[model samples]
Target: MKQFISALMDAHLPAPDGLQDGMAHTAGRRFDVYRNNVVHSLITALKVGFPTVTRLLGPENMNRVAGAFLRAHPPTDPRMMYYGAAFPAFLESHKQLDQMGYLADVARLELAIRQAYHAGDAPAMPSEHLAEIPPEALLQTKVHLAPAVQVIRSDWPVLDIWNDAQTAQSKAQDVLITRPAFDPIPQALPPGGATWILALMQGAKLGDALDAATTEAPQFDMGGPLTLLLLGGALVSLE
Candidate 1:
């Protein structure tokens, strides 16, 4: 099985020794066709999984990269959606693509979007629930984020690259992805917003998260992140 798998991925490898075509003949030409089909299908899967990467690298470049990618990190999951989960790290280590620092993060963003889109659904917390809580109690309350909420931190302008936002790369862009409806939306987070969200994800209460966020970024504001979470269906429940 191991030898057959190896030959399936690499065209250069000869078919497993003594492999037969069921007619008692060596499977030479028939094996080649089988190998071609498997390689093509895997590459096509990568293109679908990482559409943004395909566009960034162009189809020709993508084909080359995808071919190499499948060999290095073959699909382990039976589900196609779960394929290429390691592709972002693979891109980061790729010698040819290493210079494009933003490419890996862009792939990361795309992966998070796909994850959020497929995440389990939950009812979003209502504004009135929080409104009923006393102002002081609000800080002590813990927020339960939905499964569809994803926070991404990057040292590159990944959101800009994804959106073709032509803005200057003055600083890194942190992102928040939420599946409010059928699709997931990726939006840029305010400074320290990612930190705050990360804190919440780690089971911190609102006030504790605020402290961590403010220490990291004095300009951190709670309104934008809170509103985004609430409206984006990320605020599953507030305890």
Candidate 2:
């Protein structure tokens, strides 16, 4: 049964051996039609999963890419929403798309948006919670980010490209993903923001993360990134 399904999945192969519908032989023509429909459905799902990539590459090119991607990496899980998890990396490695360096980052931003939208709900740390902590202790404290928080570090202007839905002129841009409500929002991160967030995500203390970020970018300001987290409700708990 597994072999039959595998053969069916690959359009190049003919109908699986001994395939019959209750003693009536399965028609090759019908099998081909079914295969085409299945491939089309999967391609459509990829289109829906990566809208930004589709827009950038155009429907025709995106469709072709989707077909190639599907052949290389099919959905392991039944859930369609998670099907294209590897697409961003795939785009980055694709020979044809190597010239369009920003395409992968754009795909990543879109993927992050989707992930944030589906992340599990968690209570956000209230503003008053900070008042309870002493200033010194707060700096040494480790913060718990909400499940919907995502950070993308890119060498291209990811946020600008995503916002404009087309390539834009800018320098390297890091992005922060947050879901204050049902919809996820992607905002460009300030200098050192990416470093700080990556450290925090790895369980670094606030002070430690700040130090690390400052080392990466001397002018990195902790205030801006901290304010973004607080305002976006991304800080779930502080320990």
Candidate 3:
């Protein structure tokens, strides 16, 4: 019976022949209505989850894209919040949107923001803790990042695009997201900042992370990035 109901929900079962009783037993109209509701709810959830993506694609285009996405990837989990994890990759393969090269990255940035919102919270260590550590041990110390810290890097100007769409003022361009406090909200980091955050997120020591950022960008300023991380609560502690 459960299997039959599942099949019916997926529109896999055909109506059985039974005259007037057919409509009563199948309830085809009701089932269709229910299916439509489910689809609509999922689509609405995706819109909320990826507002920037929707803005870039426009309402009508986003509706079509959302419908196609639903057909291609049906929801597996009962949770609506996590439904659009594959959306970024889906955008990448969509032939119609192939010319919009930055769309996938923009979706990625939005997803990262959602993830950061749900990540576990952690307390940030005071600046004096780093000063207390011996100079020689700094390179060997394992650094920790707050749960709200999310590091995203893309060739496209995803950070700038997100800011432009979300804010009313002008700002620098880069692809990085950091949520300092529950009320402060997330924002983009400057160039090389994301790389530095990535290194620390990977459990690299302070010296190694700084070195990696320097290697990636010759003029990368370690002090500036460190300050940004500290202020954003990205650096939780050192172990």
Task: Give residue 198's lDDT in candidate 3 (0 to 100).
Answer: 82
Model 1 lDDT tens row, 85-185: 89999999899987788999999999998888889988887778888999979999999998988999989888888887778464799999988887999
TM-score of 1: 0.94
TM-score attained by model 3: 0.83
- 1 or 2: which has the higher lDDT? 1
Choose 2 or 3, whichever is better by TM-score: 2
In order, the Cα lDDT scores of the candidates are 0.89, 0.87, 0.75
Clashing pairs in 3: none
**What's the number of clashes in each of the models?**
0, 0, 0
User: Model 3 RMSD to the real structure?
Assistant: 3.7
Give the worst 10-residue stretch by lDDT in candidate 1: 162-171
Q: Evaluate residue 6 in candidate 1 and report its C-alpha lDDT on the 0 to 100 scale.
A: 84
Instruction: Return the TM-score for each candidate structure.
Output: 0.94, 0.92, 0.83
Cα shift from native, residue 134, model 2 (Å): 2.1
Q: Which stretches of candidate 3 lie over 4 Å from their true place?
A: 1-28, 134-140, 165-174
- Ranking the candidates on TM-score from highest down gives 1, 2, 3
